[model samples]
Target: MAGLAVGAVVVLALLVLLRRRYVVARVWGHSMSPTFHDGERVVATRRRHYRVGDVIVFRPRSRTTDVAWRIKRIAAVAGDPVPAWLETDHPVVPAGRVVVVGDNTGHSEDSRQLGYIDLAAVAGAVPHRAAPEGS
Candidate 1:
């Protein structure tokens, strides 16, 4: 019994550490429709790298946005050539910045209007294979 209790404690501690590195966010709008819907929950893990097509949660620091957190798919990353769809001065995505867009282009307020999102603003990236809570 004592051995089982000790193992449980160790597992609990590991979960706590993992929780700190991962964040759960609920989709709030139609931006990610078809992939994620409003009220669906996703788990995102904070890591040193992110790639195009990976959906991520971030806080928009620009004056145009008021939402505390926004979910969008990465379109470009550092060293990648800028997508022709974007109107920006830089030919390549600058270091430490990324271009993000909504899967549903018509409803997303993304890098198209907001410009490059600072990597520091990114909370985490949701794996493409993870199933959302509400389906």
Candidate 2:
């Protein structure tokens, strides 16, 4: 019983640390193709803010899907206005919004397709790709 208690405590500590540090997500769709493939797993850090060029996942505001977990490069941050082609009426990204774009424009459906994502929608920033076994 004593050993069990200690083991439980250790496991809880690890879970807390891991949750505060990183999150793992499986890649879906081809929005970020060539950079992150479908079915691949990626590790993202739960950091405060991401810099330009950082790959991130956030929710999309489109009718096709309620929640879109897309990997896109941070093009601009809050207070910055997105390009004209992306949208026409949406104001500059708010103080808590992030402008993300796909690395591959040809196939990616991102800010260009929808709009800026609120910082609250950001799940995390990808730190590294986890390759599947035998590949």
Candidate 3:
């Protein structure tokens, strides 16, 4: 009886925590390949400070029918210069925006084609897969 009661309590706690703090999403494409594989599952926090080099899951700020969360690496913060390799006319990332890119740049569509993502559109930073709840 005690074991069952403890199990119920633990399940309740997990249900509440999953509802409030994290999102479990399955990766769907190769846009973020080499780092995150297609069909791999990821757990991301609801909100937090994100830094350059962090791989994040976010929806595009621009209008698009695609609703899937895209995973990409933050290449530059709000004020950093866009890399010359991007071949974009905009020299630097504008205020309140960040430039994200895929590891497979040649085959991926990211900030270079989609434009700087809105700071608010950042859904969350994906913590290491080994520790889903630690973040």
Give the residue spans of candidate 1 off by over 4 A: 1-16, 63-66, 129-135
lDDT of 1 by residue, 56-116 (tens): 9988886554567889989899999999999988889999999998877888889998889
Best by TM-score: 1
TM-score on alpha carbons, each prediction: 0.80, 0.78, 0.72
What 10-residue stretch in candidate 2 is worst by lDDT? 126-135
Global CA lDDT computed for model 1: 0.87
lDDT for each residue of candidate 3 in 1-135, tens digit (9 for 90 to 100): 999999999999999978677767677677766677889988878765667878778887664645477878788887799876667778788787888887767667788888888878777878843211211
The whole-model C-alpha lDDT of candidate 2 against the native structure comes to 0.72
Sort the predicted structures by lDDT, highest score first. 1, 3, 2
Writing each residue's lDDT as its tens digit, candidate 2 over 15-121 gives 99997787677777766777788888887787787776678876666548633466777878877776666765766766787777765577777777667777777
Clashes of each: 0, 0, 0
- The better candidate by TM-score, 1 or 3, is 1
Candidate-wise lDDT, in order:
0.87, 0.72, 0.76
Candidate 3 contains a number of clashing pairs equal to 0
Runs of candidate 3 with Cα error greater than 4 angstroms are: 1-20, 63-67, 87-90, 128-135
**Which candidate, 1 or 2, has the higher lDDT?**
1
